[model samples]
Target chain A: MTRATKPMSLTVNDRQVGPVAVPEGLMMQDFLHEYLNLTGARMGCGQGICHACTVVVEEEDGTLAEMRTCIVGAHWFEGRRVRTIEGIAERDTDGAVTDLSPVQQAFIEHFSFQCGYCTPGFVIGATVLLDRLQREPVSREDLEEVITEALDKHICRCTGYIRYLEAVRDVALKTPGLVTS
Target chain B: MKKRFVVFYTAGVVLIFMFAAAVAVFFGAFQSSVVGSEVEEPLLPDERKALAERGAYVATAADCYACHTAPGGAPWAGGLPIETPFGIIYATNISPDKEHGIGEWTRAEFHRAMRDGVGKHGAPLYPAMPYVSYRKMTPEDVDAVYAYLMSREPMPVADKTNELTFPFNMRRLLRFWNLLNLPGDTFQARDDRSEQWNRGHYVVDALGHCGECHTPRNVMMGMKESAYLQGAVLEGMEAPDVTREGLLRMGFDAPSLAHFMQRGVSAQGGMTGDMFEVVHFSTQYMRQEDLDAMAAYLFDVDDIAAAEEPPPQPEPVEVSAEIAASARGTYLNLCSGCHGASGEGIPHVAVPMTTNITLRLEDPRNFLQTVLHGIPELDFPGVERMQPMPDFADKLDDQELADLATWMRARWGGQGSDVSPSDVENLRREAHD
Candidate 1:
């Protein structure tokens, strides 16, 4: 029997990558790994329960939302903009990482992850929260709840969630205009 | 002017008299049904133990604990808020506490509460107690349940106040409502039917009170007898028509239906929403024989074991190539990962859409709601388990979601692409609210 295929094209990181032919039901995680060679999103549960395979999808309104890559189809990202863990850091003209994003920096400072298998998802979650906070700033008192609501979906088994929460909280508190008193 | 004033005064007086008479008659004639056999000699210790054991099973079948127990609270201590159209009504504490529960009540009082919807003090209970269905329970079963309840150590949880709106808050009105709705006769074994069918009918209608939710309610919020088990939409969830025809159409024979009840998951997909709670609390713990009996009764058969095989799977429907192609893209993008490329769901991860009972439902409310909101991790009995399904409300727009739903229905669902963009928007709004 012949395998069914579909044409998919999407912008990843800042580069437009294919109207390429992919398997009809190829997962975004597999596409990131095999087709684009951008495999920062790790496959943990592969059932979308664990957010280890999360990536940031840029919405039509220019808002960034975190979505699980392991469960979403490659074609689902057609004509859309996506950002993987590999694209989160600042890069030079030579395409080399120059600086880590604030979320990554905060995660390092707080030592949020232990095995680091879940770090990418956490980073994406925190980044999405930060992006939302930019558009709609949360109150100082509700910042903790807001942070929990955002990062709670991503599971980190090795390290308790305290460090990750503290790191996210610090990022939200330290950032200007993210948390209003 | 003088004649007009006299006529108006006379009319007003007549109306007042009529209202008073109506109220008096309603109250005076309203009496709790006198049920149960005459008091016999007290049972011996061993007999009493056996009775209590049977009562425990009866209570489980009745699902008394699901309603009576609050989340993370003491079992049977009540205070679970049941939401109705009118308002929220808290389930009462039926524990053996003297002050807060039914500790001081006699056996007769307990029977009356179960059958007549009347409290020990002659106060009428809200029909939320489901006494209308419990009325068919045998006196022996009622006594057994009483014994089982009385045997338990009582908690000191006081009953929470009900927050019913307007005339529903008036407990006295329930007496009249009960008069109209409550069935008088108890369950009787039909000689023409096999013993298994009668037993199944007893377990389902009397003990299980399945009709309380499965049967559609009349305008007065009473279960419609004429449409028994024909399905009802309660609290926005569609309890699919479970009549013999409905069951057969949904690819359920007696064995499969029993399996579905006992295991909570079958080839027809796992129970979700309110049915999930029922399986978790009641049917999963039921005896296999009773489950078989229920299946028999539901299938309108004499012996479930001898029933024919489940209905044949339907042929995949044909749809426009464009629609199918568009839907396949969306399905791959959002659904294919867990549910599979051809909607043949991954084992233990997701249920296959090919035989999904929800897709076959004519009303797409549950199907749309499930897709938009998604089900959390469902852990059923034994090895059957399903991972959490992610909600697509934010991910897919109304039109996209509509196309996906319509496509799924056309391909696997034995129906047409009846879902519209407006349907998605309305369902999303309702779910949000």
Candidate 2:
């Protein structure tokens, strides 16, 4: 059977990536791995039940939400802005690693991940949570619940999830204006 | 003075007559419909085995275990709280424990309870027990079920107290309810109908008790006989009309309906909401022939006399440009990824929006609720499965959700775009409650 193809383009990591031909129903996970050669986002379960393959998508109104890459097709992200794990860290003029993002640093400091397969998804989730909190800060009392609501979906097999929770909580507390009185 | 005396006398007489009539009705409802002895002779090993096996089948068809067993609790040691309009009624333990469960209850008592909604101690049971539907079960079936219950492992769990409100808290009030709602006769085979049809009727009405949820109830909370299987909304979910005309209109034939019953998902759509429990616990375990019979009865195929044909699809209508433009992007970004760009639906992932009956519903409560709180990943019989639909409750605001629903309904559901932002808000609030 002849495969159907569609032309699409999207902004990835602040770069104009494609206006090229892609299979009609190719998943975003495959496109990230095979087409763009970006392997930071690890595919887990592939059914969207496990949110381990999520990437950040910026809405038209400049709000952020995580979309599962394994289940969503690449064409669905047409003309959209997205951020993967590889794009999270700071880069210098020579394109060398400058500094780790606060979420990444927190994860390392707290020993949040063991296998690191699920770390990318957790980082994305935490980043989105932090971004959301920036706009609408939570009270210290409701901080834990709010954090759980955001990062609860991302599964980590090796870590018991306590460290990850603590890491995210530490970032939320340390980052002023993210958690209010 | 003489005229006043005459009026007072007349009023007193009328009051007495009314009281007498009420007493007669109460006695009439309480009268035992089934006559049988609880005493039984000891059965041989072979006979006991056969009886137990038959009992198991009847119990499954009746779906006794689903209600009797609480989540993560011992089987038949009931603590499941059933929600009704009145209040929550916790299911009674039905294990073989003598003190707490129904171990000492006679077969005659079980028969009376099943047929009349009366407990072994002659107390009236709440209608949440579905005795109104179980009253239609044949004596043999009831006996088989009783045997099956006796065979279950007893867990010495005590019954939970019901938490009904005001006048409904009084069990004596149900005598009047029974007077209006209770049917006297057991299942009767229609001579004009085929055996399969009769069997199907028994399963649907008596054992399966589908009407408890599907059939609309009158003000008295009794199933309305005139509008049987017309569907009703309970706990914010609309059970769609399953009448012959309604089924056909929604694109269902016997084969597909039977297939859906046997294995939760079909080309039409997979079961969601309360129906998932029915499939997970009841219909999935039923025999294929019974499933076929149920489909045949629901579609009323015998009267058609024509060859079985697929139901015709609805003609596509154009959605308003404004709705299309507003919600199309949201749908593409969030939903279209799994549901398909054209709403064709990904096989084993999401159902095709075009034929999904939820959108075709007159009451958009179920549709709106599903969208606000997305469905969890579900497993159907065999290899059939669907991934969890991400909830848009936190992501999309009320207006966005309403627009998306309206767009979906108009574009593919053949429904009008009448879902206002307020409708989404109200349903979202109600879902939380």
Candidate 3:
């Protein structure tokens, strides 16, 4: 059975991108890099085994979710607001990139990345994660689950998992509503 | 046209100033070699005499503290969690605890254990203990570490069982592990090399156990004999490829490599992640001659071709705030002394709640237990002084203690599992009952 190809429209990194034409079932990883120059989202594991291609997808419900962009198909992002690591913290209140955001700043301060290959995806995925947690304060189990969910797919081989966990935890405490029950 | 020209002239001046300022900011961001150049720490005449006397350099070179004592454990009391593929294995008490520890072991037994991987009862130890690497230790160095431990205060805590899976926990199976492993031997000076190079090799390979993390592991997680120093993963951390071979792939030239070791950032590459820990523990402590030797050895060696590129890698997780939702109340209730409002705190006196070594140790159980129960007061002879880290077991219940420990670990990006209330209850019982 053949699925018909679909055309999609979306804003990526603030540019009103397209009502572009695309394959019916191309994986999101190929859709982003092959069709769009969104090189910030990488293809670490095509199968979503590694969360290299995570992107922030604004839902129709005015909510944001980090979709691996690799496992999801091209049509899934239709009419969605998709943000890559490049777009996480566009600018500070003062307008120049708020050095991209506290989360990015904390990542730098903590020496969180090693090869830097995975950093963009991690940053994007985390921003979306923190947003969700603020909507509902995370429970202890929720904390573990949320962390596992956000980072579960991202495979970091350096500094182990401690620094990353600490980075998010630090941001959470500062985040108020999200950290405290 | 005059107005436009005037604007252009003024803007040109402004742009020049801006350029100069930008250059300053950009250059300022790069680490400089400049320092006040305090007089280098001099070993006193007596200290020099002590070092020259016999085993002085060995203890210093071996850097026993990097492994055995760095965890703020009862100085030299061991019990730090050592990770292996098999499971989490706690370092045994090297303090003079006779039954539960090494208090009554004979010198010969210690020697055999260090050099031969044979214990006092003739049991072969797992290589995770680094006996394979320690075997290269000259007798003098072994004597120094031994002397240091013997002189330490006796800590009476019993050994914790290794949480290894079945075949690994079976002591007899380790014999097979050892058989496949090349027997460790004493370091022999290479006649072709300079004394410093040999010294560097001996230090990096033997006492330092640099290979334990750098050397790729076999299926069992034992250091792959063929790929020694190629770099591997440990306790969820990536051991940077220290070998010239692996370093080349990462684009580290010799001078830059030496600089990276002496200072923490690569001359060109970024200084991020566990490499900082390596800099803190070993490389930063090195003298120039040793650093040169290490650079030489690494650059001189060849890398066995491994994977085409770094394996499909993942970025560090962006943890959600929900993870800390459970931890926030506990931090407010039990923490906030050393850890501040945002969880940042004064180093040494109080740990920063976020992104610190103390918070991300191999095991927070000890850290939690110590914080709750307090550290054993120590005032060792011939040692510099430090304040005792207080314990909290007295005031907090298991749930509260668990919550605090879990909160602290989660709060500051500590990379560990949350301690269950049962774990806290068990530890509380073990400590007091």
Candidate 4:
């Protein structure tokens, strides 16, 4: 009945991670940090109040949902396609960073992070927002609310949340398919 | 024709040179006169006394004694160890002790050290002293601080050597760090801002140096100006964001913030950790008007460009029968006495669990930590002697602690996530460490 005897499997950052046995009580944050070496998903508050340990989980309909990895059990992510902060930026065959995604670029241009401990969660959350906007575009008037709705779940203790909002706003506005005129 | 053209060109060049020379001479004289007129004369006895008194006020505003003095140590006889990522740096003794402190330092030397981050022997000071913020202080204020320190009963406390490692130990290298991060501009009253706002800005941004802790730092340890007071983690505790949105999230208004600053408690909860120290040593002693000004400025200044509607509230979570049963048992045994069976805390005695935001927050670390460590009595004026919560770390196992926390949150908060034994264990280990 112990967590150690439970079988767990999940897709992480577009890769099939495991049908590997994990402790039943193992947190997704531990699986990512210790097992997968995805340290980008930081553990700011183990209790999930600060979304510094957030990741994007793609649902059955291909809609991305943000989830706090810290509080949730690793087994909860079974059969789910989870995207981390590491998956946002493009890399070449040599694994060198070739280009940053629009959200990543926006974060850099706006200086949207300081210590960047909470950045991965913010990036992933913002990415999910951008994806949601592209799928169902909103009017310019409603854009702020949409962005707030998407990102307010994630906490960025460094950049007063203003810069991140502005960055996301910039990306949403600049990208042709995101917003209806 | 060629000779006439040459003569005209030479004549024109000579006239331009003369004009440039006159302009330079005029500016040079103006600058010298300005500098000369601003020079301080030797202080008379009454002037010295007045300046010293002003210096005492400046010292309070600057919170010089907080970092400089060790716990239970003589004022300004610094031996307080400041923890940084690189290493521990000890504050130097600023008392006017002939052998141990700044007694031999001349006024000019003191000013240079304050404004330029240079020591008496021309060595660079570590930014831990916050000379970058102090540099923004007025020359008059600096002089007053010097006079005040000089007038104090000199404590012969020797300065402790810093425990910095490797390259950081090289004091000379701090000069380079200074070049990149130091805010060289002196404090200037912004014309567009109200006088009260400007005063608040000066106190918060310059003299009080709240940003030194509240503002997040870059990899190189420079304050990220773009973020401003967005908030930052200091020694494990999140220095909660002070922005309008952040304040709103925390349920703070101007009055509440001012009250918290002055009395270390608000509707949210009482101050703890570094904030308790801040109130005890610094903010509590500030004038009520100044605290109000700070609150007003904080509430209004740096309004996030985007319109911030509070996040949509999540649907209430339901506790299962089995979990609820165990939680009830744990709660009845431990928490229900103080925080009633209905979680209706006794008014003016115990903090009501229903109104407490700590349980409602997304992270239950604070709640867990509080349960494990207990709340020490913070004797504030006007408020009753709030009874301290006893530490339950030894009495309760992880599962019991988790159950108790879960029960409190589920019954009172109505919308919080579940707490696990692992969560309780992690927090317990952290607290122990």
Candidate 5:
């Protein structure tokens, strides 16, 4: 918990980048989330009130992880790597890139977004969440709460929460063992 | 010694303050001698006649009875649910009960509610109540509506439950919303305008909220104030914009819109849905000059687009062959006797199926209902069909009447549809009464 960390070059989504300065006490949330990038991760509130900055971070050991880029530091990846949604194949399993991930597909089918502001962050967070939950499954009540909390992680001013929950429910119901009886 | 002195001084000061406050309030309450004194008489003989006359116009403008009374529920007894994006709002009892209605409302309090979107206790009303429109009424007109309501024979109805979620149940934001929406000023007579035009403008814009339905709203849900009279949709009924430009697109001129308003005929088409009902209950009752003034004001409006009307198509007259002869035979034998052969209609009244916009409409539910169950009260003198349109709902199956209607439409190149008995049955079941 107490150690001095040094900055080093790292690969982000396969792009050579970053010997970027990160504050010693700064959260990972503060680094990849700097300057004009706020435009990418949205300042839905710096207190992590929204997950518009969610990104996937890989550890130095080749193990990759999902992270809210705002609360994590850019320097945490001193010699590590990361992948972002922008890194996904323009296609899916069969070279059909329009092949949206299950979450994106479900979102469209449910008419989940009206203004579509919080969707990108939500989509990324959900992508990582689905991967994490593959090792486990949940019950009905647990499913609704986890899905709600996952999305409640962000703020949406329109379409309310019903359609968002519906989109998640669609994914959970179909993702095989994501929701066990 | 110090405690005794303080107690004596506080008592003397408190009594003087209370008396002064009471005296100031007593005088302030009667600050407007005109308002204070006239209401004392309530309705003098001449005043009663004047008020009743104005009340009729106010009633038409308000369309108060529409939401309150419903199809045949007690007039103005309330209990209708108004839908909003936020939640459903139930209409409150308007019937005079000391505990329920405005029996407790002072005239100023009533005016505030009408013009300010605030109740006497300072709670804001749900916007569905149309205070935005009422805010435009001249004070005197508001007074007239108040007079009309006060004149009604009071009925007692219990309070109904309202269900809205939190933050929305919080009425404070309404005040904030109103600050953004309601125009706080009262209507002042325009020195440059004609008396009739000024009066009509005041009545329609503010008290009538004609624009609330006609004008489109903006991002914040506020009316795009500058583009005042552009058309907007209401409960799926598209109220054509009464503005000059809007009229051109809708294919009407001042004369046409005016003529249509008087009769149920839209120059482009016939009124349907809520507008159709309004044609009978509200506008048809208006004086010719008032109708003329409304048309004039809308036509004379500055931004009218000069446009050509689309060419007319021959009217529709679809009927089923199976029942065509029998239906026509039925109409000639049974209906023509009361309806007249030409369908130009009997003099003074009786809706003509041949050319009457109401009868020639694609769906003849209201016409069919009036014909079947009969209209309430509205009887004509010379025309025999005046008493009731008589329901032959049982006699004709769906297609037989459809064929007859088809025959009528084709009779003079009129547009009509095949009436189905099921449409009749559905209408009967749906009719509130």
Candidate 6:
């Protein structure tokens, strides 16, 4: 019942982090922002309704799913491999961002975000969708449905929803492996 | 001797007439010059264009588009419904459509509407128009607004009638309301204050109309000037006090308040609810100087001491095992997902239940209303994502709502009394009506 007793550990980005003692009810969002300083995982709606706090988690089977970090406790991520927004870019030897992820680039080219607070979640969600599609490609006609299903939960109060959707669609179309012609 | 006297009297009469004529000529020349300057000359084409542009800026300051434009409707076409305790009053079309909007309204007519809350035909307009505040606008500002509105592309949307109950259905009754509340005149720059302070006062009191929401209303639903900016509930959300004492509680100073107005984020948290929309539509678009001035004025307001001592604490409700179990069940089923099991809300995300002052208010009406209707998503600049709370009205009955509220108050609101089922029902009916 006490806070200090909970066992927590996870592989964040690529590195293994903590068999650290996370207090009971410590949100994964706080664990990332406060302890790790990975602010890319934003705390949007602690309620999981706005998926702005979404991070990509690799399942035991090596498949990815978007998880809401704000609602879940840090202890819940024990032994999990999670990818945050900070891990999305391709870094050079000096850790300088060499190239942006296709989704991130697409978001930029289309001017998909205004404040960028919601961008991290959108990137994670889109990344998961792209990963899923490469394994199981959908027809071009079903692309809209797939994008909606993936990114609909993330709320972007600015730039409307159209630009974000279009950006996602552009990536899906251009990334040859995602859609069947 | 008689002929000589007659000749002298005639000469004197002629001299008197000549003096009177000279005085009349002088007065006529002075009157014409004064009258010429008083009457505004017709604007040149370039001047008209410039004035129209300025009018657009003034319109933004006045926040005309926010209330007039419905969600996804044409800008200023005016179908937005304003919810009130008495009824829903829809905003009228101010677009320049001759048939459906204000295109046919003369300049004087428009000025009268803004200054007197009277329509083109002398019909009394509802105070929902905020004419009470608009009346403080200068004639030049009013004319500029008219010019801007006239220049806009007219949307031919017909105005929707207001839905009100019995006595409120009478628009004529607003004349009486106006008589009681309206301070009929334009803004006068205070001689004692600095220019910046006076400008700030004008922006807050006239254009921004901050008191319309922040000031508590009386029994007649008129704003309580004495308690200005001390806080009040608006449309089921608490508009926090912006007065000195209230700002002090929030730990805000002039610079921070200025920053909040400009960016919609402050040290406290992101602006949410109606204030979010206000920042997005109005203050964020304002000049930095104006925002700083408003902040300066706000900071200068003398702190009103707490009027009365805090109300005596109610006896704590002792929870039996069965009652606790029931309340816990309700809370877990409905609230635990967002509020968290321990009510430790994720910072900068969902507001923590533990620190939520709404649950501990003297009147529980807002809490009940929020539960029934849910909080809507507000768009704040820089703060990207917002989630709307889903209404439990359709899902939960009165008793269930009471149980949930009571549980929340007991667990989070330390000294709060239990909310009864009847209390829930009364609030629900008030909300519905």
Candidates, DockQ = 0.64, 0.26, 0.01, 0.01, 0.00, 0.10
Deviating ranges (above 4 Å) for candidate 2: A1-39, A42-47, A56-65, A69-83, A106-115, A128-152, A155-181, B1-4, B20-32, B35-49, B303-307
lDDT of 2 at A114: 86
Candidate 3 docking class: incorrect
| Predicted candidate 2 versus true structure: per-residue lDDT over B111-195, tens digit per residue | 8788888888887888889998888887777777777778888888998999889999978778888877887666788988877
Model 2 interface DockQ: 0.26
Interface RMSD of each: 2.0, 4.6, 21.7, 12.4, 40.7, 5.9
Top TM-score hit:
1
**What digit string (tens of lDDT, one per residue) describes model 4 on residues A23-129?**
65467788898888988989885645578888988888988878777656676677889988887789887768899999889989998888888788888888888
> Which candidate, 2 or 5, would have the higher lDDT against the true structure?
2
Q: Give lDDT tens digits, candidate 4, residues B89-109.
A: 999899999899999887767
lDDT of 5 at B183: 64
What's the C-alpha lDDT at position A47 in model 2?
Answer: 66
Candidates ranked by DockQ: 1, 2, 6, 4, 3, 5
2 or 6, which is superior by TM-score? 2
User: Candidate 2: deviation at residue B304, Å?
Assistant: 11
A31 Cα displacement, candidate 4 (Å): 46
Task: Tell me how far candidate 2 lies from the true structure as C-alpha RMSD in angstroms.
Answer: 4.5
Instruction: Indicate the residue-level lDDT of A28 in model 5.
Output: 46
The residue ranges of model 3 lying beyond 4 angstroms of the native Cα positions read A1-61, A64-181, B1-63, B69-73, B98-100, B219-222, B233-245, B270-274, B301-433
lDDT of 3 by residue, B1-433 (tens): 9999999999999999988855553333221211112213333445434544344335545555555653666765666777655688777767767876677776566776777676768666767678778888776566556655665578767667779888777665555556556453457888886665676687678866778778887886667878878666554345656665556544456666677676653223223334555565656666777777677666663221221232121122333455454454445323442345466544433434443434444355545656665543232222322234435565456766666666565545334466778877766666563
How far out, in Å, is residue B52 in model 5? 4.6
Best by lDDT: 1
Q: Is candidate 3 or candidate 6 better by lDDT?
A: 6
**TM-score of chain B as predicted in candidate 2:** 0.93
